[model samples]
Target: MKANVGTLDRGLRIAAGLILIGLSLSGVIGLWGWIGVVPLATGLFSFCPAYSLLGLNTCRNRPH
Candidate 1:
């Protein structure tokens, strides 16, 4: 898949995901934090299915 997630977007997603995971593991965020894995995976892979279906590209014009 094309990299529809840019550096900044990926970074944010990763950070948010890590926080959610951390909080959940620490018993501070509850079960909702489990959803963070989705963003984590998307950021780690630089691809998001929703973005693809919506014709969105956060990494547009980016080289690499």
Candidate 2:
């Protein structure tokens, strides 16, 4: 998969994911916080399935 997630987007995703995971681990948000794994994986992989389904791409160099 091409990198549909840009640098800023990826950074934010990673940060948010970490925060959610941290909160979950700390018992501040319960198991639902584990959902952060989705964003974390997408950020690290630079691809978002939902974005693809919605025909959206954040990468600047995406091909036409």
Candidate 3:
């Protein structure tokens, strides 16, 4: 998939995902925090399925 996530958004997502995963592993946020993997994957890949479906691209340098 094309990159739909921008730099700032990707950074935030990665940070949030890491925090959630860390909390989960530390038993602070419980198993549900594992869901952070979704954001982590999307951020790493620079793509978001939901954004594509909604036609909402945060990327500013998409090729025409």
Model 2 C-alpha lDDT per residue in residues 1-64, reported as the tens digit of each score: 7779988999899999999999999999999999999999999999999999998898888896
TM-score of each: 0.89, 0.93, 0.94
Single out the weakest 10-residue window by summed lDDT for candidate 3: 55-64
| lDDT over C-alpha atoms for residue 52 of model 2 | 90
Q: Model 2 Cα displacement at 48 (Å)?
A: 0.2
What local distance difference test score does each model get? Answer: 0.91, 0.92, 0.93
Q: Write the per-residue lDDT of candidate 1 for residues 1-64, one digit (tens) a residue.
A: 7789988999999999999999999999799998999999999999999998998888957654
TM-score of 3: 0.94
Deviation in angstroms for 64 in model 1? 14
Descending-lDDT candidate ranking: 3, 2, 1
Off by over 4 Å in 3: none
Candidates 1 and 2 compared: the better one by lDDT is 2
Instruction: Compose the digit string of candidate 3's lDDT tens values, residues 1-64.
Output: 7899999999999999999999999999889999999999999999999999998888889778
In angstroms, give how far residue 28 of model 1 lies from its true place. Answer: 0.8
